[model samples]
Target: MIEVENLTLRFGGLVAVNDLSLVVRPRTIHALIGPNGAGKSTTFNCISRLYRPTSGRIRVLGRDVSGLRPQDLAPLGVARTFQNLELFGGLSVLENVLIGAHVHCGGGLRERLAARPPAVIGHVEHLLERVGLAEFRHAQASALDFGRQKMLELARALAIRPRILLLDEPAAGLRNREIGALDRLLNELVERDGLTVLLVEHVMQLVMAISHRVTVMNFGARIAEGTPAEVRRDPLVVEAYLGQEAAHA
Candidate 1:
């Protein structure tokens, strides 16, 4: 559903991403994995329009998204969560997720803030239940533990009702139990809800277990792209993670 072609991003003399290209198919989980400074996040930023690419193009469902603004992505059925939590500390969990519903709401900010229609409230409540945060709807967002807070962010992103979701390191700081739950949740999102996911995660077990396809990057370019097993056995991918001896072994 998303295609990036020969994308390059340069910061003066340094290149953050060099002619990187990849594809995310519909109704599947696709992973972008690399070591630090490998440009996985930079590629995401470019697709999300947070960074303007120095060269090449990005297409979402055949529409050129290279020039589309961040706000414009929502209406095109794109939603994402950051590597770091981006939630309103003072707001209730319900209130925070409700903000995502604004993407579908009509009228000025005042009108939206005045009184939410019953449907919006119901939708937010349902999302809370789905994300296992039903009881915490009225709780202060900052009061939740780290794992729950991450789930809250996911709920808020889903509130956008997106067709494609981009998740940046959604498993970074979670406990093993929480990570397993996350794995199941992501599976349901694709298998049951028909959502497409493009994730950048360092957790290899989670990435290999859940992703239908994986792209490995190094030095700002794609080093390998294939199914999890294929990538795992690739000499270059092995070399990138291990040393030369491991690759040749």
Candidate 2:
């Protein structure tokens, strides 16, 4: 559903992503993994149009994404969550998720200010329930614990009704139980809802358990791309992580 061809991103003398290429198939979970500074996040930014590539091409569902703004991608069925939480702390959970529905809203500011349609209000309630935050719909975003806050973020992203989801380290800093819940949520997203996922994560346990394919990078270049088992046994992949011991530290 997403393709990056010979992608390169450079900042003056610094090359963050160097001719990296990968394809994420529809209805599948594809993982991009590497030690720090390996350019996983850079590649994600390119796909999300937060950063334009210095060279090469990115295609989403066969349409080239060049020149498209980040907001443009959302209407085309793309949604993403940041590695860090990006919720509005002062807003109620329901209000924060309603912000994501702006792409689907047809009315102008005046209409919105007048009131939300019943359908829109119901949709937000459903989303809160789906993310296990039904009772917290009126709770302040900052009042929720960290794990619930993350789920709130996920609910907001789902409010976009995306065909493809890009997640950057969704498992980071979560408790084991929270990660397990996330894993199940992801499985349902793909297996039941048919959402394609492209994830950049350091949690090998989550990546290997959930991803159908894994791509490993080192120094801004792809070193291995294959099934989780294949990547786990790859000599170069092993070397890349072990050589940096910093990966685990």
Candidate 3:
């Protein structure tokens, strides 16, 4: 569903990402894993047009997305959550997720501000239920637990109704149980909803178990790309991922 070719990004003396390329298939989960500063997130920013690459190409469903804006990317089938949760602490949980549907709101800022009417309230309620947050719809965003907060982020991204999901470390701060629940939820989206997911996560278990394909990177370059099992067995993957000095050190 997505293809990136020879993507390169540089900031003055540092090359954040170099000659990176990969593909993600429809209705499948693909993972990009590496140590910190490995350029996984930089590549994501390029695809989202949050960062302009120095060179190369990015295509979403055969459409070139190299020049698109955050707003333009959404309706062309792109949505993402941040590594650090970006929620409106002052808004109610329902309000935060409802903002995701901004692209579909079909109205300007004035209309949204006036959506306090009963009609708007009803639609917002349904979106909350879709993310399993109906009971906390009116609760303050700051009151939610970490796990629920992560789910809220996903819900907000999904509110855009994206075909391709770019989940940036969705499991980063969660416990094992929360990660497991996330695993199941992502699979459901892939299986039942036909969503295509490209996730960058550090949790080994979730990355190893849930991904159909895995791409390993080091120092801003592609090192390996294959099925999860194949990648795990690759010597370079093992060297970079398992060798402490190569990855964590």
Candidate 4:
């Protein structure tokens, strides 16, 4: 559903991402992983259009994305969550998620001020329910635990009704139970909803347990890309990222 060709990015004279390319297929979890400074986040920014590539072509269904803007892509069914939570602590859970619906809302300021836009209220409720946050819909964002905050972020992204989801470290900093919940939710989405996922994560346990394919990077270059078992058994991956200690695991 998403394709990258000869992707490269530079900051000043240094290349942050070097000739990277990959394809994410529908209803599959395609993971991008690497050591720190491997340009994982930079690659995401390029896909999300937060940073234009210094050189390369990115396409969604053969449509060039190099010239497309973030607002332009939002309506095209691309949704993403940050590595760090970006929720507004002051807003209610429901209100924060409503912000993700911006791309679907074309009303002017007056229309929003008067609450006269089309009825997406049902859509909002449905997203809240999907993320298991319906009971906490009216709660303050700050009141929820870190796990729920992550789920809230997930709900916010789902509010866009995306065909593809870019999730950056959804398992980061979560307790085992929370990670388990995320694992369950992801599988449910893939199996029931048929959503495609592009995940950038460092947690091998979680990625190995779930992802069908794993792409490993080192020093801004893709060193290995293959099925989970293939990636796990790769000598370069164990030597560079997982280490011999983890190789035994």
lDDT by residue (tens digit), candidate 3, 1-249: 899999999999899999999999999999999888999999888888899899999999899887688679888878999999999888888888777777666576546544554655566676567567889988988899988898899988887778999999999989988888888889988998899999998887898778999998899999999987777777888787746333332
Residue 155 of model 2 has an lDDT of 86
| Candidate 2: tens digits of C-alpha lDDT, residues 1-249 | 999999999999999999999999999999999899999998999999999899999999889999899989988999999988999898889888887777766565344424566787888899888789999988999999999998998888888899999999999989999899899999999999999999999988799889999999999999999998788877788787734353333
Could you say which candidate leads in TM-score? 1
Model 4 — TM-score against the truth?
A: 0.93
The alpha-carbon lDDT assigned to residue 128 of candidate 3 equals 68
Model 1 local distance difference test score: 0.90
Off by over 4 Å in 4: 108-119
Please provide, for model 1 over 26-143, each residue's C-alpha lDDT reduced to its tens digit, 9 standing for 90 to 100. 9999999988889999888998999999999899978999778998999989999999899988988988888878786766555655558898889889999998999999999999
**Clash totals for all candidate models:** 0, 0, 0, 0
| TM-score versus the correct structure, for each prediction | 0.94, 0.94, 0.91, 0.93
What's model 2's lDDT at 249?
31
- Model 3: lDDT of residue 197: 97
The order by descending lDDT is 1, 2, 4, 3
Deviation from native of the Cα of residue 239 in model 4, angstroms: 1.1
Q: Which pairs of residues collide in model 1?
A: none
Give the worst 10-residue stretch by lDDT in candidate 1.
240-249
Pairs of residues at least 3 apart in sequence or in different chains that clash in candidate 4: none
